[model samples]
Target: MPDGDVNAHRRIPRPAWDVINQLALRRCTDETHSVRFRRGSEITRWTLAELDQRAVNLARRLHATGVRVADRVGVLSTNRIEWVLLDLAVLKLGGVTVAVEPGRFEPERVIEKYGLRRLFAEGETSRDAVQDIDSVLSLTEPPGTDVPELPAFPGYDEADICQIKQTSGSTGTPRGIETTAVSVNSSISEVQELFRHGDGDNILVLLPLWFLQQRWWFYSALVFGHDVALSGYEDAVEMAQAVSPTVVMGVPRLYDDLRARIRASGAPVDLPERRETIQALLGGRIRYLWTGSAPATRATLEFFNDAEVPLYEGYGLNETCIVAKNHPGAFRLGSVGQVLPNKTIRFDRDGVLVIASHHPVNTRYTWCNPGDNQKVWLPTGEIKTYDLGHVDDDGFLWIHGRVDDVISPSAGPNVLLPPIETLLRGLPGVHECAVYGRAVRFLTAIVSPNPDLDPAVLSDRIVALNETLRPEQRVHAVIVAAEQFSVRNGLLNTQFKLKRRQIEERFARELELVYDKHNGDAAPPVPPVLVFG
Candidate 1:
């Protein structure tokens, strides 16, 4: 390890290599430490000691089932205490964990692809889906009644691949990203150093446990002697109010939806009153809000800022965990804060972002196409992020868009799509949308408008937006999709980012008709838009 990394580890109370031991240490010293989980109207709390005991007992049960070092054990469930217990048990036994988001992807395919020795799935529906598979186990069941005791903690190397996290699959299929104990611990330490989380800090995790970041926060709570409340996205608002947590991490879409609801409530015009209203809506205890996973609108950012709400945006990838972040101590609008310590970033000649760290999460993809792996994970231990971005003089990072997602029309100049898409998503009645066209005569979009948004009103909004863009960048027409883009529909990934390829494929005929009608036009012109499912 680099000297910098060695020094960084000093902030952590115990070495992360033996994370279970570290949790036990916290349990010994901090009897008040606890992790809470919300299920319906009831909340479950587990002390550090309880958490450690359950995990060890569960590990014993797993060992009886023949689970061993390096076995790929899978967990399919929503955000729950069982998910955390199973993950800890797997790691304690020196096994790899493949946490699949329940119902997002077919459980059978994940099990087959990863060659899982055992799959612990939750819910009767999920269990029935793979009842014929002998390897499948019940995730919701309590730890077995009788199990052999662990004579001693399992032995393993910190560098061994311990976890496989799935990418958001926005551009293509979700690939498994390998992570090691050292990397996971390094990330947790870096975050703790940045925030200095301690007593009185209660974190509410709203994202699914399948997300690696969420799990990292859970581990941080165990190591740092703080409190954590886990809940699914549906109850995020209610849980926040119920728990009065000091920290909440969410994506831009969730914030946008909250912004809509807050606006619908007609916040007070008085500045102080508005601030109080917004804070109360979020449980009145949020010290700061963390958002990422997608670009946030300036309007949304400004709304929070004007109300004195600390909504800090950050940037990172599944490959390079948490490259940059904005915090209360340091923040900048339109930038994902400064690049975090212990990581170095540079832009390629094409302006694509590249990052390197002494303690990287992983150097390569464990489950992805060979070509895809070659393009992103370099032989030099650097992760090549295909995102176009640059650091300002102050060192804050600003993202443009993906190089592959850039739009290039045959007749007009090339243009980026995110800036335009961000503007459209900010408009009322627009749920989600995607701009599509490559080497084509004109640009077009497929929008999923809210049910109440009038067709004429949406057309007029698009026409108004086009007037602000260059001819090549203007969206001449759009197909208003009747169904919204969601995880169930396969138009979006679990992280709520649009699956561009899937969206374009779903609306191929509409796009062809759009070009056929407007191909002859010499310049950008607003035309009658069609609404379809």
Candidate 2:
């Protein structure tokens, strides 16, 4: 069967609500347009028609099992074709799909909190997490013909809440955010125009499918008729080699680690050769890379750009989808890029960035901690972001740090931690770092060094970093953390943002020691600063 040349011939863009019909049309007419994924040694491909059929079948089965319109159905799984199928199936039945991370949050709690009647668990871990649930189903189940046929498109409205998701919580707790079909569809439309995704373009999704952005890429594939290869972090590089993907969407940590690995491989001295090497490292058909969710170090960004690979960084939240992004046609080196067409951003008097959209994804939290709603949602229909940043004259958005993360040292002036922490992360031997100083004479840092980094080298790097900073912003001493900060340790959130308050409390004594040592000549001895390679 030949690939249907529908995109070039279409006169009107179909809304996301019509995605099932579109898939049916494509499957029957455009046979070659399909979703592809890898699982272990086997690879599976499902045509648009096949995908739509499976979704319809699943929807019928779900309906028979008492799942109804507006019911919240939980999906806890890894990145696989089944996840997409289940998502489509739920949408077809006009049910809201609640995406839940398998290990990060307790499944029972989420089920009770969201009033989910049933859960679709894929992997063993996810299944185990919901063992006690009354109506847990397997996402890996094959489509059955026993159920009656369902309507191709149910009574789904664009304004109805179709999904509930939580952005990575820096506070170690998930806050559910409501999403509508209109918002998701609008986002896809904006992205399609901004990036111009077409045939032969494949976006390799390495992040968990539970994330909204990852699923957005999948929906885009269905709408624009491109390929999307889903894989876990462990097999991202291997899967890339197999698929030769043109676009790879990932978090900043993945890029940072890749940069480190490239440098470790003894990169070429020549710039062109280095660029070629980097491209070849990722299967040789590279178009561009997308990074967000956390800050990518200057060194990591520079490394890819210096190699001539454009790494596009975007800014958004679960509450606001994508606010701004750096695309192929327009970009600024240090900025997240110009605000998207529908969204507008402005800075407050205190330098906090606030966002307002004509069609906001959400206006209130579906589930969150107490008082969280009043803090962010304003009467003007603008979201008051606590992030401190400024827009350049040309409208490029540059983020400095969170407003609350400012370190007010007693003596000279206040300092922003993110920019400094970004610099420290780029320093050799430092894997991760957090800078802090509150009503103190000098700033102190908690450093997580690479295992192979030498202590002497780290000391030298810190000294060199201080030379480039203002007197007040310089870190006077560092307390080397015993372990790397990660989601498992409660030091970092799911999105890789540092839990500043938790990290500070976790190492209170060491911080106190470093502060006391730098206070005066008669203070206690300074803790040894150990650096890892």
Candidate 3:
């Protein structure tokens, strides 16, 4: 344990060796449902013993493939039991696991950066450059090991790097985050103490394994003796209903999808009953939900909570993994809640949140080599987070906008767009809205309103919103989206956050029209422009 740090309440023993060694010491009571996940069309369940043996067997296979200790291994796959199995196998062999986002497939960069020699690419087209993973799992695979006897678990030290996590690229290029066994294990222990998750808790994990929260849930589950049910976006609701998971972890987009479904189902008409039904649909035992990555709509938070399933928002980034969260003891509606135990937070000169973690964290980006310690951190170990926020007197953290996103309009006053867009989401017929500016004089908006809204009515609403803003900050004009921004379209990411640069480029012509109308001699047609700048 580090000096000046205390974990008086962390009951579950922090890893003496690594999590794998501790789990190896754990004795299953015949009631532990360690893992439950679906293969292509079949479901598989693994008990604690079975899960351990599989990792042990897989560890031998990994070693046979020439995976030396401290070697880097890449995994590019969707969420599945294999991802977990391979991760454990690599750790048991004292290797590093690097998660590469599937579909985007940037293996060359990851390989070059991390010096990776092997890659486990499941369900992917064989690239000529990397080793293909052979241990593709199926539902029919028997409980017993099919491989040779288990080798000595090339045990790892607490300081050995075990995982490399990539950011969501919310602001810029996704930076790879490195972590050691001590940090990862300590993190699981910290969260376990906060939530008190135990054997009775069945966690439904919907986000892909590449996501930070998804990996955190899995790590916490195996060590904490909880069961994890894995499912994709398409089957999450159905699986949740069947699994009856006690907790669910996901991004804000998931709740948005559910809220949309409930609206279509007319469930909110009866708040109490609707809450029960909805929670049941999401696996009735859901005590409270975990959400982060992006800002969740206030309407979504209030809707689920009003119905009984409290949606708790938290804050963290790729750099500082799980820094603060809103738990049952301390929760504020729009805030990301209080900083977690073993952490200290303060604001920088520009109101950017600076964080100091008592737990071990990677100090620099291995690939890019961010900067020297003095420049990257404060004297107290608080690292500067580009996220702009303020802590209230009550100790709750409230995010305002991205420091880089504080738009300075050459034509007028500064504008903060997140709040404006957040307000627009509450409007009657607006399904989604994205406000845009920068490299331009005034603000412009690209709105995706509910299809049922009357064009005339929506136009009026946009005009009404404009009246509330100043000349420089007001949305100069609105362009109603022909379709919802989607990940496939390159306008949105997997988290449902607008890819600002992509959206601006995609709507460059429309944006030009908005500014042209704002400053040009003639009005660039009404109604089509929606609202004038």
TM-score (all chains, Cα) for each model: 0.88, 0.89, 0.87
- Root-mean-square deviation of every model: 4.5, 6.8, 4.5
lDDT of 2 at 95: 82
Candidate 2 at 67: error in angstroms?
1.3
Best by lDDT: 1
Return the clash pairs for model 1, or none. Answer: none
Residue 476's lDDT within candidate 3 is 54
Give the per-residue lDDT of model 3 (tens digit) for 1-533: 12232333444344332554554334334346677888767787878567756676676666765777778888888777888777776776777888888765466766776678677786445564364455445321443454444455545566667788776444445567677666666666667767888778888888778765576676666666778788876688888987888888877878887887777777658898878777867877888888988898898898888887888998876666777788888888999988876566766666777776665567765554344344455555567777787788888889987876788766566788888888777666666778877656656678765666566776677677767866665665677778777777787777667788877777778778777666453432333357421
Worst 10 residues of 3 by lDDT: 1-10
Model 2 agreement with the true structure over 238-308: per-residue lDDT tens digits: 88888888999988877887888778889787889988887887889889999888777778888898888
Candidate 1 regions exceeding 4 Å error are 1-21, 24-30, 103-112, 123-146, 154-156, 168-171, 527-532
List per-prediction Cα lDDT, in the order shown: 0.76, 0.74, 0.71
Better of 2 and 3 by TM-score: 2
In model 1, where is the ten-residue run with the lowest total lDDT? 1-10
